[model samples]
Target: MSKPVTDRLLTALQAIQESQGAVSDTALKALSQARSEPLYRLEGLRSFYPVFREIAGAPHRLQICRDGPCRLKGQALAADLQVALDGRQDLDIEMVSCLGLCDCAPASALNETPGPLPDASTVIEWLDNAHWPIPVATNNLQRLPTDPYPGVDCRYGAIKAWRDRPAEDIIREIEAAGLQGLGGAAFPTARKWAFTRAASGEPRTVICNADESEPGTFKDRHLLENAPHLVIEGMLLGGVVIGASLGVIYLRHEYHQARRRIEEALATARGSGVLGPDARGPGLAFDIELFVSPGGYILGEETALLEALEDRRGEPRHKPPFPTTVGLHGGPTLINNVETLAAVTTILARGASWWRAQGRGEHAGLKYICVSGDIKTPQVLCLPWGSTVAEAIEGCGGLSDGRNLLAFSPGGASTPFLPPTAADTPMTFDDLRAAGSGLGTGALFVVGTGRSLADVLLAQAHFFRNESCGKCVPCRVGSAKGVEMAESALEHSPAPIEQALETLHHTLSRTSICGLGQVALLPLVDGLRRFPDEPSLKPLKGFTTGAD
Candidate 1:
């Protein structure tokens, strides 16, 4: 028999959450005391997830998305709701930076359910009667392509593909396919598997990051909701190649729909004999469990995610001894984004030739592109490589109401923005960096004619500041200072920021521990670089200067 998911800290917390609507301090205390661990450890785990609470004061907690895409439409909507609900102590309103639902703006999480999607105005009904509508169907697996991960049947394909292939053969197949991480890093996937396979550790682990929290990114949610089986197959293959018997999919709590869908899929898969003990014949044991995060942008970082999974504060681990060698309870571990693994199933099944055929040039294979903000048709599209930003915009019905394109980020929020002049630039990784941004998660948040560029920058700064994990001085202090600068200069000249921003950007990039601080510098620096002639901030001529 497979180990019960509850034996793991993430699932144990899930158990508590399922039984009660919220995870309270009392529950964390009991679990920690029963496990003979320190209370702080449990507290650390309980605190980061926004869905869990320390002091239970309300029957329901509502978290709304204030991410860049959502800000295009939801910011004002949320503000109005806040005014309506003000002074109501029975409810708590939390603004979650990004809910990964750009297509459905003004999205919110009520208690543990994902919603208000098309019915965002329904909050009025909930506020009046404290009654939310039943959650929309999330387990619409029929929406998935019948054979999303080619070669293997979407249902029993993984079990058929594995048939107990040797670890070396499986590893070589992945290497030949030239698969790379679909997350921003784009690191080679096979190389990661090989390192973990060779590392010295008992009971190696595989972790899939389904926390699609990056602003403007939501393709993974579509996949998990439609074709979760494909992702599971990839994890099973990853386990076989790396000698891993344990797999965990750390999902985002706000994605209550995706969470429910994947959970149901896993149970169905186990029943079909594709998962759990006896999954790989008599002696071998391999199974997967699911975990949900409370809420934090920094939690998306792999090591910080591991820390949260182990019921600790989410902090990025220092480098040199990377996760492959010393990760997840000090055992060798393999970490991958959801899309990366989903792609793996297709590649190994159809072979490298099929993957190469899908590409038009050196930039091979299809990428899931999410186009939102000021567009006529906002949707997630899987396009082949070498496609241009202009093309993606065109596919999304070419700007809403034919508004002249203004500035846009080629990828997610962490990347630099490009003016209309660079609209023709290709979406390849190298082309984007050369153009001063990256093809981050292949998402384009096109800013339209009417939106204020300064306001967008300010919104970006607010997200980084609010999401900083407070682990390193560079991000902790730098992001806060950045918020001040952006807010100060939004309505006036941008000059007061020039000198301060230069040093601040350099300090953040050089001294920050992870990408949050480093990427946080982009909006300010890139905003100025893109529009150098924006109104100058009032000069600091009369002020006394401090030593550098």
Candidate 2:
């Protein structure tokens, strides 16, 4: 129970007008109504919002993936479900980007609640166990065989404010929640906020990093499209704790709908007095703005994103002035990923103990996983941290065509591969890291029997080679050499292939400027090590081992 922005703004306006002397009530009401109209209209623009609000008391959204790899794996079921549930007055279904759960095609959410089916063997089991009967259609719009949220109250009651009331208290609550950044890097969010708070300055700024251009990842795009207000709330709370006056959401260009939703949400937040000039209760004021990125994967990196915001070329800058100190036109700015920011609002709304109470072991909370690749229902699966890969596959209705799960990328293309034997490992950053891969963005790409390891390596290498910004020589030259080596390996002997891969791996990992160059050889290196039998380098008729 927070006061509506419109009411707060009206009160502020009244006070300002009284201080200035007498003003006509009709004129004041007209201005207030006019300001409020835009937000209402924007809310009405999306048919999903009103229905979601009716049931969840807010815009509760479920984003089902509909991107490239997902589409290849029959993810369109989510879009069909979206159409069927469009005007349902109970649920909001949206076609989201990759959702990082590409390996679990056709994922959906219940309200803003995250996770796979709490407990159920199949789709029918979920529907039968639910309080309400699920809508069923045999056609393309068939409901997913998993419960979006189970054993949890779909009602907003789960989000209760803490008894302690102070900005610092709120920050401490977030710290205790054990929430980590979900935008590829698993850095502690509380520490990130602490940096900004400790920085020497006034008028600090917070930026929501929605520029999700990572290949094979798209959870942020879905969050932006479906729950822009959540992101707004998160930024607002971050601003409140750290004393930031301004907040900006830097979005990627390719996400046109996400940008639109965010712009609309910002307008709603401003007009309603939830953001800008005079927002919410007394002694609290923060404003939010939107800045679209120029659409590049490199821009997703924090330094490059800051540079892009200043209208400069989106390239990595040298750190140690690290964003917390000299960031965004030289100010103490805190930038967090979209998912990380969204989690902050949840942390504030629900106590730190509540968030901490979710997951087990070292993870300590839930993770919003985006599954892609050759899975039956590629979508975003929000599972409690430490859930096994087998559980994730089951959440997505299992693999398509009963194909054997050959190998999978635990993170994005930048991370190393994990063979089927590793699938049983828990899907947490620490666990994945221990298993020789980092959960970089929680992007899972499942490769089946027919998919060649060498081909996959070549495709991923080409992507890195194409995306390298050429700011540093190691990345530019190394990625090219890596691609060349990978392609050459396809037609050469085992020794030549080994030599080329070793050379590329050494240069890329040791001499690169940023994480991009440093990890560019991951796919090749990991694939070679894990699946030695797959890379059969046979010499072509006239080709020699050392020949160009």
Candidate 3:
């Protein structure tokens, strides 16, 4: 909770943005003085985050979500804004990535605030009045993970269960539950905590990653808004196990609803003595706070998240010293995904045996998979592990009418678009990987039959291209070239798409630093192999390494 430069800048920015719709010069000066840094340094930091604005007396700033889900609605949203903003020098609008409002397609934010602008009418009102409507909080969290909706009556049961237990014993329960990190990697959750516990550092830290911006992945938004207490309890338990005094939730800016819900939960926990000094027991000082992400795709990476948290650009840091060993502001830290943390709370309150009973063979527990796209009713389902993707989709009344599921990204945009044959594959962490896609954030985007796989790949290429951090050449240039080739293939045939993908894979695999480079492999390689006849991929020469 020490005032790092990151917190100072964010605090100043939030205050000014709330009161005046932009970061004013006076507030910038105040932030500079607060951090005791030169104005140039502050300026660089300001420019580093794409969403951060240097206002300059502009009357308004409009942020439109250009992520995959919003793109599904086409450019109508941006086009409408373009028309409204025509000849208005007072208005400054920029197209940005996911706003965590994927549930409501064509989402937008006023200034830096997140909300659902479902139509042009909302946009017009906001443009005229500088404010918009926020939806009501209706889903009262009456259910735990085990039972159906409004499940067991144990509200905050995990916190109460751990009130007198030793931290080591609590950690042991988490390990026994067989819980893994829900954020893409699927690393063992207990192992991550154990590493941080043994690492050499004082005042260890814990972070909850609620910055769920991957397109078609809105489950975290559902969890936070409906069951914020679960994630908070998991964070508190994690704090106790790691001897962490300060915990933070690095929330995405697009989720204003989740932010408000978590804020209320934090207040409730503190008022109930589940946070603050000795939250678990005497001498166990632990608490949690929320830090908003300053809009960037790369910041989803843990190390990059830490870098941004420390008032720097959201770029990947070199490894050999991972987050468990050295993290945050240079302290041993543990960052868990929102779903993983919520699962941790459930596992602690309910025994490991109970959790294991939910899944089959290699997949042992309930997976919070978001079944979206081309479906009658997109939903967040708690399907058993090892459950087929087809089963998950059917739970929500199957695909829309006569449309067949042609392909799907089993786990968000980072995953590969597997054909219908792959739908029978078990939706487990290991099973998905063996099938060539990881159970990333457990969000599935189903593509209907007859949709061009090349068009799908092209959309994804543009995503990776626009969002690449430019920290490494392979990701930056490879993504751009992928976009170019995809576009070219739409009209002409040159080199084989698969060859180029393989060349990029070998070049960017381990060399390009982080997940940005590595994840592009899934869609490209899998697209070529599974979707061989995709017309959007051209047959070109010289695009690949000489061998191909």
Candidate 4:
């Protein structure tokens, strides 16, 4: 029999964590000896990833989100619930960063099974009775424009149609469609493929970055669960174009439901000759694998993800030779987000003109946006590119409880918050950026009146601070200190804290190695700049724009 693959350290660690509820010292010692790896390396991994634990805790564990969306919904819900269930012997309750289920604000995961946070009494009752709460259904997939074969059998039609065509032809169509990376970078999709194909490499890699852990972002999860076939076909086409034999979907760990759907779809594809040896043609070989992340927001960063896949701590690498030229295993890697790859299948199946017509004005193709926070009906919507923020809010049934809009986060936590006057801004990257914000990951977090702007802004900073991998000094110290200064500004005088934050933001923006630190203090800085006259923000007046 073939020997088991001992090189997959992260996979082995995940298996141990899954079966034992924690990676105890005993288990790590065994793993170190079995894999012939040092103990310090395993310890580093356990400390870096939040998913890994050194020892098991209470029998039942409940992790509640303490990020932007959940705070907006109910700032004290988690704390109150904790107090109500205090001194419990059998259960443990902890607040964590975004659960990536922002649509269900005040979300909780009971023993890693996510659901809406019920009353404390209900939880206590479940603990006493040993009856676990059923996880809320997360498979609310909507029909999106990117799905070319809607409600029909997914027979890998796009790949079959373009299989025999020249790679140049497929690249040209994608270029004509004006496709760009939808994962906030906005790099040209065709250019990335061309660079990888031309680069001097033997086995290029294609990665679908499904690790969308940004606060208020869950559209990728929706697509993976609903339209897995489209994403699979897109990856296969990319492999064929770039001569890559291996592709991986680096999915986040909390997305258990989406993971199931992807696995089912991958099995169907492999069984039908769409993936495997000779899958691309007579001589070409290509197949895709699903790599669940150990757990961290930094792993969503491209190079950081590369580090994790290679069985190391997830930390972003410096740029000079980008991933397209030098990537996974030191080979050319084409890394695109879930939305970008799924759209590729549509662009190639239907002509480029049809794809262009799906947008409004100058923008091309549809956009998947996750709308959450203070909205009446928080959900994911696949709208035409250039749709205004007001339109998206309308689709979500407007502000919750008939409250008037005060300010809005145009995108995920990294994006700056824009005032209500900017509600008419188009959701495109250029338009939102022109308005002093960005469509980062296309996550819209609505904030209605009466909400504490300072609380919301500080919550965002705390998230970046908490999720920082501490790989570099700038991000490690700066994020934590920035959060401290922001929190102090609320209680103490804001005069001294404003200048300190400005200088710190300047330092982080210039010296940080990755985007996580670069945009760590952006929300607070932007809130102070944009809402200087608001009651909650008046103490921090005269704030200048520095970090963007």
- The residue-by-residue lDDT of candidate 4 on 1-548, one tens digit each, is 11122447888998998899899999999999988899999988888898898878898998888888987885577778989899988888888888998988878899888877777888988888888865574966666667788555655788989988999999999999999999998989999899888888755888999999999999999899888888999999999888888898999999999999999999988888889888789888888889999899999999999999888899999897888888988888989999999999999888899999989988898999999999999999989988999999999999998799988998899999999999999999899999999999999999999888878888899999999989899999999998887666666755446667878988999999999999999888877777867677655553322211
Error of 1 at 285 (Å): 1.9
Whole-model alpha-carbon lDDT for candidate 4 = 0.87
| Candidate 1 least-lDDT 10 residues | 539-548
TM-score of every model? 0.90, 0.70, 0.89, 0.96
Model 1: pairs clashing at backbone N, Cα or C within 3 Å: 49-294, 50-294, 50-295, 493-536, 493-537, 494-536, 494-537, 495-536, 495-537
The Cα RMSD of model 1 versus the native structure comes to: 4.1
For model 3, name the residue pairs that clash: 143-151, 494-539, 494-540, 495-539, 495-540
User: Model 4 off-target regions past 4 Å?
Assistant: 1-7, 135-137, 151-154, 541-548
lDDT of 3 at 446: 81
Cα lDDT tens digits, model 2, 1-548, are 12232333323333433343323344444544756544333222222111111122213345444443544444345545555455544344555433333333333334323233121233324433544232311112121111222322331111224222566676677779988888777788888888887887644788898876555786776677666666777777777666777887877654556766788878776776677555524555678766654345677789977765653456789878888877876878888988888777666665677676677676676777777677787767778888888788778887777788988887777878888899998988888889998888877777777655666666677767767777889898888887776675465533345556776788778877678888877777777766655533222112343344
* lDDT winner: 4
Q: Which residue runs of candidate 2 sit more than 4 Å off their true CA positions?
A: 1-165, 280-284, 491-495, 535-548
lDDT of every predicted structure (CA atoms): 0.76, 0.63, 0.74, 0.87
Give the residue spans of candidate 3 off by over 4 A.
4-7, 24-30, 56-62, 75-93, 110-154, 491-497, 538-548
lDDT of 3 by residue, 1-548 (tens): 54443455655565566576556567678878976877776676666676555564556666777766566554566787678666766567777766666655556766556655545566667667766564422243444454322432456677777867777777788788888888888889998988888898755888988877777788888888888888888888888788788888988876777788889989988887778787867877777868877777788889888887876778899997998888987889889989999898878777888888889875678888887667776767888888999898888788875888788888988888888888888888778889887788788888787555666666776777788888889888877776676566455545556677677767776678898787665576668777655544433332322232
Q: How many residue pairs clash (N, CA or C atoms closer than 3 angstroms) in each of the candidate models, in the order given?
A: 9, 24, 5, 0
Tell me the lDDT of model 3 at 122: 65
Reference-based lDDT, residue 484, model 1: 79
Model 2 residue 465 lDDT?
78
